[model samples]
Target: MADMSALTEAEAANRLMRLAKLIAHHNARYHAEDAPEISDAEYDALVRENSALEAAFPHLVRADSPNRQVGASVETSPLAKVAHEKRMMSLDNAFDDAEVEEFVARVRRYLALPADAPVAMTAEDKIDGLSLSIRYENRVLKQAATRGDGQVGEDVTANVRHIADIPQSLRDDAPDLFEVRGEVYMAKADFVALNARLMVAGQALAESKNEAFDPETVRQFANPRNAAAGSLRQKDAAVTASRPLRFLAHGWGAHSALPADTQMGVMQAIGRWGFPLSEHLRRFENAAELLAHYRGIEALRADMPYDIDGVVYKVDRLDWQERLGFVAKAPRWAIAHKFPAERAQTDLVAIDIQVGRTGKLTPVGRLTPVTVGGVVVSNVTLHNADEIARLGVRPGDRVVVQRAGDVIPQVVENLTREEPRNAFVFPDHCPACGSEAVREEGEVDVRCTGGLICPAQRFERLRHFVSRGALDIEGLGEKTIQEFLDLGWIDEPADIFRLSQHRDELVGRKGWQEKSVDGLLESIRAKTSPDAARLLFGLGIRHVGAVTARDLLKRHTTLPALRALAEDIIALRAATEPLPDEPPHRFQARIDKAIADHIGVENVGAAVGHALADFFHEPHNVQAWEDLLNEVSPPDYKVDVRESAVSGQTIVFTGKLETMSRDEAKAQAEALGAKAAGSVSAKTDLIVAGPGAGSKLKKAAELGIRVIDEAEWAEIVRGG
Candidate 1:
């Protein structure tokens, strides 16, 4: 990891902004959507980075900082809303036994109890599932709600009533007015069976409709936790009724009466009252016994019927819990001991190079089928060639594959130390298109130069073209593209423009209606000539990102002019005589000279030039180009700058913008013809400093650059 101290104020500010957005996005995907994209450890690393930066630059903290936020976006469900009487707070986690000991000691210290005093705690399996608060009045289950942003939740009372474990009417021993806080989860066996059943049903229905089945669309839960959440939140009670979901009472919500004093006693009381309780729940007198129970559960995690991410330990006595109440988002009295990721040894059968939409090659480890964390693992990501090299793993060797939070398997270590029969050789040619796979300068991953020629890149490339960041054809998403591609109605990017040609054909498809079909075609027609920058970005060029594409388009105006210039520069460089003793550095210098001398496009470099040249020169990609252009004629790029105070000047923005995103701010500056530099330097004509602006403000003062607030920035843009 790089040092945060070494980061400039501008860099830190930008990083803080990016971290805020990334963490928020992952939070949404993990909490509200029941679909997490990254592992828990990976997510933790991001949080740690954000924390480190914030600690070093406290003045730069934004209003949307993840440190202050609890859950992701509040999930707005189709079901009725239910406000939690007592907030369903999450537990602060302890990864190791030392942290567990500290938690116990913290409790003891807070209560001023002696270290030798028996601070009892109940250790129970941490069931990974959606949190539910079931409120009962007069021993009758009144409502059940999901933990939506802690304060309010989606009411699933009708749906939860169908679950056998969650009794509609509690037993006589149940408290008069109390809520049963528990996890609504799917058993491991049930999750597998549900997926299998859905897959079989999907295939039969697809066959009946004379179409292919997509098992993913039918049941795409990555784990039992996701499955449980998805199943429990169904709007239709009948849908929830069909699935197997079970609940285990753990604690309480707002209560009028108590059946027992200790935490274990309350849980036992709930269990006797017909609500299911975790069978692993046990009371321990000290930290060692609690951790011992945690370790025992960790060993049994893989073999359990359902997934258990860790063990939870709460101070057993109710009085102790009251004294050591809640902290920020979690209970200070309760701490969860998270188990490390599950791992299993599997034989590596082969290394497969899979090409992505952008033509980047990824190595996948084909492993002999093994089960870890109750899920079957047949393949793992080697990550890259570097990973393969680092692991020294080869085909026919045994490797340890780990499954953490993600369903995707990863190679952790190679167990077999013996040499391979034959050394594993990474192919230099793309298997998808037989193109020269080149590892570009300063890039770790190797990529196929085939571009649109590669079969692997075709569909994905088009999908990227119409994506929100690109042409943004509103109704045409990935699924629609897939449907079009499958029916041979659309193959190339140009085919999207001609979708109206097959409007009748599209409308006939089961899910495609006349209104939707027409709407989709209208969106395609509206994007016949997308903004030059977006079009260039959608091309999936090797090194051309959206920002670079904008920079290039701002300079070249049109795709043809840019292509002509790029090719001419490459040809001009080819003709230029190389230095007598040409090394790699000299070669780079020669190309740099060609770009600087022959082509004076402001920010064009060797890598961008090479990518553009290679893209235009490829025959199949050229064919794709002609086909696309023949359908939709593109206009020249034009930035009509209205005379403004900020126009045609170099501007630097620091800290949080009050009204717009950083990207939008940069785009606005560019539209009015200002160079939005990332740093504050002597060349800067203007600096827009927002609240929490730190080092950049000082730098602007030192350089004597005019600094203005975000309001002033708006005024300048408004031609005030």
Candidate 2:
């Protein structure tokens, strides 16, 4: 660790700020989606560093600090509907046996119980699957939901009914109102079979086309947990049923009455109620027994039918749990003991630069295939140019690769050899389109300037166009787009609208069914009058995300008007190039003035302004715009479209928004031309306070900010 004593105040403040951003990103990925990019252990380390930095620089704590946040609002899920009666909180973790002992001691200290007191705990395998809560009323399944942001969850009643392990009905003796919480998983054996089946299907299509199948085109799961998550979340119940999934009950949620006073008793009762219970739930007398059981589970984790990352130890006595309560997002009465990260040694054969849709170039290290944690990893990301310099990694070097706490494989260290070798040279141009690659000031990543022309950029852009946040065309996922590109049937976003013209050609193709093709055509047809903001976002404009697009379109309502403004910009630029109207220097000065006047949106500044102007001036981009405009007649949106309390007001939402998601709330605000600022300041006009309002709430009170409760906020939006 860096010497904390040696660091300057400014340096400490900067580190704390960086840590806040890093931790918040990982927290959202882990808590909200259950699809964490980094391992749980790695995430914990980041949090630790953030805490240490904050301890040193207490005054530098950000309003959006990681400590203040919980799981992100689950409102993004289409299935989200039912509000959880009791918050489905997560468990705190213990890194080692010493921490486990410390946890027990802390619990005793909190309760003021003596060391000699009989303290029993229940230790069970921590299944690495999505957490699900099934509500039972009158001994019948009422609803099933995923733990989305702990407050509200996605309703998956229809999908859960298909899982064999999830009981449809409970015994008559069960509580009148009860909620059973468990992990929904796919067995290792079934996961292998499913992947095998997918491989066969993929191969059959390739053979018919007389070409080799690319694994990239296949929507295979990265791990068993991911497979289970993706399977259970399918829009079609039949699709979920076809996939192998199982559920193992380990806990309870929102129960009307307890059958027993201990954790083991509840598990036994849940098993009797017809839901399959976890086999590893056992009562232990003290911390020694707890650690033994944990170690035993860690040893047998590889042989288990399903994936498990750790063991959970909860206070056996029901009264202790009530007394212990919660700390932050986790329960104080329980702690999860996770396995250490896994590592493997591999040879770095080659490093290739991949250009993403946004033009950011990522270095992918191709390695001699090696297995780490039973998964074969052939490639690892060196992250960027900075990572390359940090590690001094070169091709043909021996590297220590690990997936211990990361979803993506990473090369952590380079084992340099004694043999003489030249230093590696990074590329100066895009490998795909040969465009000049340049890194912006203060940015680590280098990007290609080639927009629509780069092959990689074209493929990714089209994929993003059909994504849920964009056009949201159903049945047109990445794999289908890849197949179309391979067959030379579609190349651009405009070509997507022209798909129906190839109905005859698509018929009887290897993987295309008449029903699927017709479904895709129907989806495309439905998007003819796509939302202006969504269409703009779908265009893959540089520096224009969904929110920025909405904000820009709110200012300049229609594509035609936006195009007109761009034309004026082009005219100004043209005037500088020996035009008859004015002197060159005077024309250049006019162009600068025109750009500054036209770009007046709240958050958009010079950088965004220039990106939009340059994008519109490009010939190919203009042609594509014209073609797409003809294909899908996007509607014109008024700047102050929604006449509501939120319109024309700078709003800041603090704490948990129970009514709608953060995304939904922000979208509603922007729909009315109100800018949603991240932090509250003197400029903030309104603050919507929800439950658990902390620093932001205190700040609002100090400033005498106009504050509205969630109920009041909901009522206003309802009227609009």
Candidate 3:
């Protein structure tokens, strides 16, 4: 420790306060935004500096100093108001192993226990995202909300309905009313995938620093935290459906139904109820064992799939927890030991631009493969144009990468000695398919014009087509699709139907045998006569996604009619182009609206309109449909469109959908005669918001739309 002989008490106090403010600001940006400008090392330095200053002037340290806090106050805009049955207090935090040990000692002292007090602790990765509450009634989901100031919160019933980890209808024997609390976060892989999709579609990037993440960026997502928070608040279920978000249950507030007398039992019971529980969590019987677990997790933090800033330790006994309740903004019964941020240096091999299925462009850094914990790290996702500009990173540059807890690897700094190229070019062509790419006005991503042809684009399109969102094809999954593609057993989606004829060939392939091939053929055959909406989506037309396909099929249910009308549709598109007497781009909105209007479902709006018009007007599209139709029989036509409180409702389900996967829910909605929309809107009748539902929910509630809980929604759908 540096000698502080020259520093006065006043000086030390002033420095400590300044350090507190700076560290708090950083934490807000990090925990709330999910975008960190400073390097992990730099952040660590700030925390260390703050700690040193506080240690020198303990009297000046505020009780609720940033150094001793678990999370910032919950965001308020989107969650609905509900007084917590038990206040969702924050946790006191510690920065290192020493601090964690000290925290344990303090707990022992407070309880007046022996030096070796057999106090147990459970160490869970402290997820760096928004906290949420999901309520269940009689083993069925009731209402879901966020923790806003530990009391009143904006209702995000729709958004909460999107996450797969959250059970839509609980199958547990716990209580009449159960309110499970967890962190609503975007998985690193999902975050990467989401960014990819947005880039492919030429959408905006989420905002980073609230101030820096501007609308001018292609998609305008606020960091993962903001994005996740925004997604959970949507009133229009469809909007929340667009984001890639997830929920990991950490603790709870109220569960008058549970007989279990401990938090561990509560978590285990819920896990048994089909809730997605964290696998890394553990129960410890002693403080020493808990510290060991914390250290072990800290060592493996770099390999975690989600961001974790710290580890939460709570009194396992529910009775004990109740006895040692709230102290100001935090709970006296629990504490969080924040692990120091760790960094590693790796060689940046190349910076490449990737075009996603939606046409949004993104930069990815290809790095020399290194093991951060147990996982191999060969690449790191670089968010957008502004991020690239800020990092000053280039191909062949040596860069510093940081991973906190088991979160995805992030490039913190570029530190190459050699002067490199000043900038990396954002590609103007689809790297996978050579299509002329363009960035939309006010957008940053340069997207590919070739929607279906690009390899990456094709894979994504195929995935979506067969996804729980589109045709809901079973057995034909990502691996199977890639395998079939490589073996030349299938090319276009139309080939899926033809696979039945080549069952012998499929069975003869490298890994497949008679049984597997037969099962695969059976699955394909089952979907051969898929519904008109499924057929429309499976065709892989640009702008004509699941909802648009369903909307169009509602008007023209047969393939021949859809094909016959293509020319006229193209002519209509020609009339709507911004250019004089020129045909609108195949993906133009006016044309989509014209089709929706002429076709019906006037509810079909701008985005779907553009998507459909583009798909229909493409010259090759008609032939593609003709070919697919000739091979496969469309499913028996059923226009089961239901007119409900949000009738003619168009909903999109993104991320892991609760109750059912996204595809099942969408198919079910269509089966009910409701138009399943791809994005949220003012006209949306109801949003079946599930867990991981993000910004769309916020927008919906902001519009004063009625958002219902999943259970109430099920009742409405069942005509209760």
Candidate 4:
């Protein structure tokens, strides 16, 4: 990590922006998708680095900081979503004993306890499984949900009914309205047996079809935690019933009445009510005793039936917990002391390049099958070309791999970098489509420039087109997209609208009934008049995210207008190049300013303009765009501006919002016809400040702008 103190404000801001995006991506993978690209240690390191930078440069914190987020959103899940009565927050992590000590000392300092005063804490194994919340009413189970983005979760009531470890009814003494929060896990033996069974089933099915079986094509769970999550999250309760799963209660969410004043007391009560509690759960009066217990649990981790990555320590007194409250997404009175990642040596047999949906080439190191943290590791992510160069890993080299948190396997070190052999070479052309693969300026990733032609990119692009944020075609999931792509039924976004032509054929296919076929076609047809901004975003254009698409559409009003502007920008750039005697930087700046002026949209700068221009410059892209437009007619983009005091005003919101997310606050401002700016300036009309309001607040005061609390802002909104 770079020295936080040494970084300039601009540098810190840039790093924070990158860190925020990186963390959000990883959070979505781990929380929502049941897949993680990086190990827990790597992810934690990114968070810690972000925290260090934020601490040093508090004023430069981005709105999308990882510190402000908990779990990822479940907007894309097929299951129905339910809002949690109380938020399901994550725990802060402590990697070393010193950090753990600091946590205890911080708690003591917050409560203003004397040095000798004991602070009782409960320590329990941090199970590496899916987080679940089971709600009960009148001692009967009502609903079960998987924590999704803290505030909301996917309803899994039917699935949980099949897990024997989870009781349908609590004891008569239990609270009538209680939400039991815990981890749903699969035992190590069951995980192994499950994988074996999946493999056998795949082989048997292939043989029955008189085809060769490819293990790579078979869906196997990455680890026990993933197996447990994938099993429990099944849409079919029958599938969940077939899996051997268990649950252990760790805490309670909303409750009608408290059964105990201390955390341990409530956990004991939960245990007596038929929910299993961790056997290693213990209460300690001081930091020393808690650390000792953590170490003891770490020692027994290998022998445990289920996977546990760390030990969670929480203040035992419920009153103290309430007093400590929460900072961002974690409680101030608790921390998870994590164990070191498990490591093993393996041979790097080969390096394989996989192209992602966005056309970035990722390198995967094929390793000689080895065991790490009780799981067989056949491959490890090399991340990209830069990582491969840094590790100096090539075929026939020994390497060290680790599975941190028993999730993703990563190559940490190369044991034979000094060996006299040829270094692995990164491809300069897309392996899938033979298109030129080049790294962009200031970027480490080598991406394919194939656009809509590459097979890999095409499949991913089609999948993204039907994603939750895009057209949201109900029955068109990744698997279904791949199946259609394989059968040559769909090739581009426009082709999806024409899928009804194959209705009869689709009905005859295995797993496709007449009702399902009709439903899928209906879902696709429903998007014929989709949201203009969503359709633009669904095109998977480079540098055009959902927000950017909305901003551009808001300015241009229609897709055709946006395309015309893009073409105009292209013409303008071609007509205005560096003069013969002019400096390159000066000429570049002039053209950039011209493009920005032409677009005339806040946050839509020269990068987006150039991306738009470059996209339209390609004849193939223009053809694709026209084809898509022919299939659908999106209405002109318009913001529903309500007449209000803030209408036609520029508003800047700073600090932490307690009741809503930053995006929600910004959307509310937009709804009120206010332009929500990130930074305060002289032209700002109002400043909605929350707790932790820092430099922006000072700036607003210096500019003599009207400032109000979140409650006041809410009143203005309500009145409007």
Candidate 5:
């Protein structure tokens, strides 16, 4: 973990913002799609880092902080959403005995009990499965839902009925309006069998089609948790019935009447009401007993029928629990003591370089199959060239592979580093296109300069182009893009617009029907007059992000004008020369200032200018750009400016906007016909300063620019 002490407030705020986005992406993948790219340990590490930073700089906490969220949204789910009567909250985690002890101590302290007072708690294995809430009305099953963003969830009542472990009707003595909350899980054996069946089915279908079976094309669950989630959340109840799944009740919500005064007693009542309870669930008088039980469960983990990543401890006393209450996203009365990532020794068979969409080369280490926690690990990310060098890893070395957070396997140490014969040489050329790859100064990644020419980069770039943040053409997903790319129907951004020409051929294909093909083509045609900023951002130019693209387009108005400016800047840079008396640094600074002035846009600096110039400098890029423009003519960029007091004024927003995001503040400014600049300068007419304004606030005062608090800015916005 990086030192929070070393980070400036601005840098911390920026990191918190990025962490918020990164965590949200992973949450959507895990919770919504049932597909996780990183391990549980990796995700936990990120959360911990975010928490640490937030703790150090509490004011820097973002509105979208992971700490404030429970699960991903279910808006995109096919199933109807059920608004949870009571929120399905998550639990705080503890990794060590010390933390566990502290949790018990904290609970006791919150309850105002003496240090020696016994705080009996219930301890049970935290099942790694999809969280489910099954509501019962008048002893009959009413509705079942998958936890989605805590407050809302996808209705899976029809699907849960297929799981035999979940009782359709509770006992006669059960609460009339009780919500039994538990995990709907797949057993390890069932998960393995299901994956095997899927593989065989995939191969059989391939054979029927008279095509070679490709193992990579077969969809298989990454883990039992994912398998359970994907199986139980199916849109079709018949599909859920076909899969073997089980449920174990841990708690309840929205109960009409109390069944017991203590946690263990209530769990017993729930078990008596025909719900499967954890066999290992036990009550402990103190933290010591709880820790002992946790260890016992950890020992039994591998032998268990299903996956469990941790043990959860909840205060047994019901009234005390009520007094303890909840925090932002978790109960203060309970904590989950997570197990450390499992590790094993494996032979590093080979290291392969894979190029990402951005042309960066990532080294992946292939390993001899070894089970770290129960899942077999064969491949691990070496991260980058620097990581490989740091670990002194090479092909044919024995390495320690850990299933960190038990999701993604990674190489932690090269055991045979001292016994290595020759150090592996990192490749300097793109493996897919044989293009020159170079590591830029101050960057750890070695990237292929081939850009769109590289096959890997080309495929990824097309996928990104149709991504939600880009042109976002409906029906153009990863599989469709790859299929089209393979069929030679598309190669560049321009080729996407030309896809309508292949309508007949597409409809004749196996999966593509006439309606679907036409719909896809229509979606492509819709982008003929694409937003200029989106089009520019979709080009995958270096150092030019969506915001920067918008800033540039706002100044230039049109794509042709932007290109013309880039060319002029390139010519000006080429014409400039350093004087003999001028230092190299001074000359470089002068050149940068000239470029910045030439662009005349705040935040779009020398780096962006140079990137644009370099992109247009390439003949192939220019040709592609012209070809794309020929296929689709984007309209001149425009912002719907409204008349307001700040009309035509350049306003800079500084520090934290308590009720709104920085982006939101900027958008508000744009709507009010104000130009939002990034920095406070002589050109800046006003500064909207919030808490922790820092250097920008000082600069605004120094420049004698009129500054107003966020409330005052809000009032101005209201007046506008």
Candidate 6:
């Protein structure tokens, strides 16, 4: 063995600093916000790297190195203080399919149990909420506290008291003191409804400038776990009570109420004592049966009402559990064998078009409701008409639904064997407003010709207008805005900001109690900082995507500048109507070239300019802008984004990449400063041609696009 006795203090300090930053970044993604930058495998690699470094240079590890810690360090006031009898240690997590399987094998090996050993597991929704310890004394619920620092927690007895599901007084036949710890999460339905209610009443909403930003008002939880944590620590008990927060017991930190012979029995006894234990948890006798149970859990995850991060596998015998004990933070006897986050495979029954509040017709796939990871995902998004056609999907076909990372659910494949049920015909009329749908040339999506009169477009437009991305309206949703629209509460977008005149009408609605309506109206009254991008996107201009919206905002920086650009485009078009003698194809090419050149200066293209011209040329479009400007002011933003990394860069990725999957790599490049062209082109920056790269490779050579393998791509990201 190496001596390892000559480590210096200075060297150790540097190591500790790096570990702290890495762990902090991971925690920020994993706890504060739901979106994580790294995949589970990448995260595990970092964790292992940190762990190895700590072990090698033990003196360098900080007290707060993630390898040695669990839970957040943030502290809040106004909660009751309760010390944990046993530390509420966090579990060791597994990210993907292989890690989960590995965990099962390791557990069996360590237990000295038979190859076909009898074991059991509990799979429950890993609620994206707060964690709390509710203590009971002599069967009477005494106090509840937030999971502050594992050692101490703030008292939340009053707010806990408000949760009807949590028994205030346990059954008489109980032990002296008991503690139950679990997550408190807001239901999706409840959250949606609450947002809707807020919108109906007309309220202001908060916006996050950073994707990593976690706000208090928005249940913008990092995941089910963080959501639960935030819900438990509200300063006001009434605010906690008002939230649709509920608790489900996963396990106990300390308990004297049930016999410790078996954890299953303990769970049953806990449930008998009025704790809300899930009915879906199961026990298995052998590894085969355990694996089967996991599959069953995976299958049932979507149907279940709550969100589950993964499945928990544990040894059945309490004595065995005692023998196994724990290693570091995680219990040796129990491992959470989580299923890959909520996924579902269903028949892509049909593709249906939905006219948005902006009159943009979006094609949505209707599927058999199958649970993928945990959520009952019945409808996978088809994005736009272009995607549906590209996928070659039609009605009555089986499709695989997948939710990769935090990205929305999408149809991955056409798994159906049956073919040729009539082709999906794009609708000509807006289903919501009955406005004739028009697909402009050289564009992907079809838009409603109806403009504002279409109810769907009107409603969606209003919502988008008040949306954080647009106008940042605090309290407007489909329901409330629809109600306002139906009741003549507001017609034009400006009317929302000027709703004081209809104060009497607003308060008279069925759900609009005086206090709620007043609160909502007050929230709506506080909107002054509208930005140029927000206003532009709010207008629902077709082909002017989110990126383009931001670009326009940055370039113009003010409403006046944008108005001038619009006027220039309008005048330019008026002076140059299509030449009658000009060949249609030649004229189209010339128009495309001119538009491309203009937008190219700002890194935009022909499509965006044409879209802007179309909107500005219309009189109604000008009126909408004027109406918006009257009520809101545009924010100043400096346009200084470098040409995106993928901009004009053609990259074709093939085979499996250790860092990211094909689609993921594509998405990352697109998100970063680059352009991910489908095929290799002369403009290609680098062809990330992986193993099994076929035609793309041949094409790349022909086009003189530089081809590189996966290793090269990895090197670029690592700054090698």
The C-alpha RMSD in Å for every predicted model, in order, reads 11.6, 10.3, 21.0, 6.4, 8.7, 18.3
Q: In model 6, which range of ten residues has the least summed lDDT?
A: 1-10
Candidate 1 matches the true fold with a TM-score of: 0.57
lDDT per residue (tens digit) for residues 1-720 in model 4: 887766544445546655776788899999999988778988998999999998997655544568879899999788999999999999999999999999998887677678788999999999999999999999999999999999999999999999998999999999879999999999999999999999999999999999999998888887999999899889999999999999999999999997899999999999999999999999999989998998899889999999999999999999888767776788888899999998999999999999988899989888899888876778788878888998999999999998786555788899999999999999999999999999975456899999778999998999889988888889999889989988998888888988988898898798899999998988888899999989998998776767668878877999999999999999999999687899765676688778878998764556667779988999989988999999999999998765678898999888988765575677678667787898888889999999999998888878899999999999988877
Global lDDT of model 5: 0.85
Q: Compose the digit string of candidate 6's lDDT tens values, residues 319-365.
A: 76655555445676676554553346678877778776556688877
Predicted model with the maximum TM-score:
4
lDDT of 5 by residue, 1-720 (tens): 878887554446446655676688789888988866667777888899999998997744544568879999897788999999999999889989999999988776665678999989999999988999999999899999999999999999999999999998989899789999999999989988999999999999999999999999998877788788888888889999999999999999888997899999999999999898999999989989999999999899889998999999999999877756676688878899999887899899999999988898989888898887767778887878988999999899999887654355777788999993899889999998999999974356799999988999999989888876679899999999989998998999999999988888898798988888988988988889999999998888876666667878878999999999889889988999999899865676677678878988854556667778988999999999999999988898997765679998999988877766565677678668787888777999999888888999788778899999989998998899
Cα lDDT listed for each candidate: 0.78, 0.78, 0.66, 0.87, 0.85, 0.64
Task: Give one clash count per candidate, in the order shown.
Answer: 1, 1, 78, 0, 1, 48
Candidate 2: Cα lDDT at 671: 54
Predicted candidate 1 versus true structure: per-residue lDDT over 1-720, tens digit per residue: 349877654446556655675687677788887767556655665776887887897756654566656665454456788888998887766778898899898787667678889899998999888888999999998988988878888899999988988888888767789899989999988988888887888889899999977765675466788888888888789989999999888888999999999998898888888888888999999999998898888878878887778899999899877656554467768988888877889899989999988888989888899877666667776766877888888899988877666455677788885764666777899999999998865455788877666778877898888876678888877787877787887777878888787877777688889888888878778887778888888777765666567767777788888779767866866777767788755666566556644545443445566667777777777787778778776688777657766676999989877665565577568657787999988889998888888999998889889988888888877773
Q: How much is the lDDT of residue 337 in candidate 4? A: 94
Candidate order (lDDT): 4, 5, 2, 1, 3, 6
TM-score of 5: 0.69
Score candidate 3 by TM-score against the native. Answer: 0.44
Give lDDT for model 6.
Answer: 0.64
